[model samples]
Target: NQPGEVFYTEYTYRPWIQIDLQQFIVVTHVIKRDIRTPKVPPQDLYGMYVSKRQWDFVNRGARACFFGLTENEYNCRRPITGQYVTLTLEYEQDSYLDALMDLKVFGLPTGCGRSLGMTTGDIKDYQIETSSNYKDIHQSRAMQGIEGWCSSATDMNRWLMVDFIVPTEVQGVILHGWYQMKRMFIYSFVVEFGLQEHTLRLYGEDGLDPKIFTIDSIQDVHILQKFMFLQNILTRYIKIRVIDPSNDIACFKAEFIGCQVYGNKL
Candidate 1:
């Protein structure tokens, strides 16, 4: 939430304030508040729009609601699915200055895109274990940080494992390549999961054969790449084994997505 008022300069024409909802959602309504201030009166808001495309902020996006005159809140006739919500000013005055006090958007998450506390700190440091690390670069760094986990260059048997502690329905994983002085990424990797680390099974179409996922090219480096499993797996442990490490170093950041299983057992 932003504090104070957002004002547009006099020279700025058709100024707009945009909010990124982060993920795609089904927006039901939007609220615009104009708290009365002694020095500056509430500026008029003329348009409210939502869009899945980042560039479509104006007329191309779905119109949530429009106010001919000043209004406190706006509601859409139908729900709009989008990741961005934009408020634009449409008026006849060329040099008019507008100020927006506060804006609120109501929506629901599209899918099981919610993080399972990998970067959110719900999963503790001890929960993440690695085979080996390069100097001070530990496994915990993969949770959330610029300097991610880097395995020792000499260690050929490298793997990073996460203990969910409880049974979890893991849907997907968000992987980010490590970058600092030099660029490092995983070219390909294998995913394994099980109730016990000793008897882990490979993630594949068939439970016996190994499934290798390739990163394709170096263009994917330093970007968050998501890999959704073919089917939801119920397990307490998930391990990622590097098959092809770039620069002979397995370095990356990771976040798991899914919800905890209540009654299901392994």
Candidate 2:
């Protein structure tokens, strides 16, 4: 090591999830140095990127989280080393519950955000040897059919799809859609995702067999201008289908703008 030289060190983390789909969040940063420095002014951290999050609404089966990252590239000019600091993540989207359900059948636990499910007592992640199942079709129209606009002046519709990667060892499959909303105030529809590349048996929420080919690829869902957000999931993917909802969803316009995965491995 030479004078005026600096380096970064990280403490490794081992993650485990019991649920079939896992979403966990971790906050990380550098520890203050053990040694002291001259009485120079505090230095600033540069060239680092972080995510800023402020949650407004929290509910069961779903939550309203706004994720934006704070990014910068520079050196810390401060003279202090042993002080507390905070950083952010890059998951900049309103992650949903359907995204969670998509992986419950055949996906394995992996990466960050894999442990953040609605329930805590559940396993950190789970691997399924069974085939993944889901049906998407005309019956797929949900939130759109829900009556009452949260508020006017705001119109929006969102479509989401999750990809689940099952082992090549698996065979055929069956998929289902089950929805429950404690209050219909802001909730618009029953989100659905179709399974592609894999065959499936369709079942309705009422527990009856619905003999019909749901939807083709995610594109077949037919919602408009469905902006796609980057995300990290094992081999599986989850998608949400939101209707043209009014504003006043949350105490605000309840926006489902975007989401980004950490770019971690599957």
Q: TM-score for every candidate vs. truth?
A: 0.60, 0.20
> What TM-score, to 2 decimals, does candidate 1 have?
0.60
lDDT of 1 by residue, 68-152 (tens): 4445566777887766787767665564435557788987877544578767778887888888987333433444655777789
What's the residue-level lDDT of 187 in candidate 2?
A: 31
Best by lDDT: 1
Worst 10 residues of 1 by lDDT: 135-144
Per-candidate count of clashing residue pairs (backbone under 3 Å): 0, 52
Give the alpha carbon lDDT tens digit for every residue of 153-254 in model 2.
242433333233331111112122222253222232333333342333232344554323232233312222121122211223233333324443311011
- Give the Cα-based TM-score of candidate 2 against the true structure: 0.20
- lDDT assessment of candidate 2: 0.24
Which residue pairs collide, candidate 1?
none
Q: What are the lDDT scores of the predictions, listed in order?
A: 0.72, 0.24
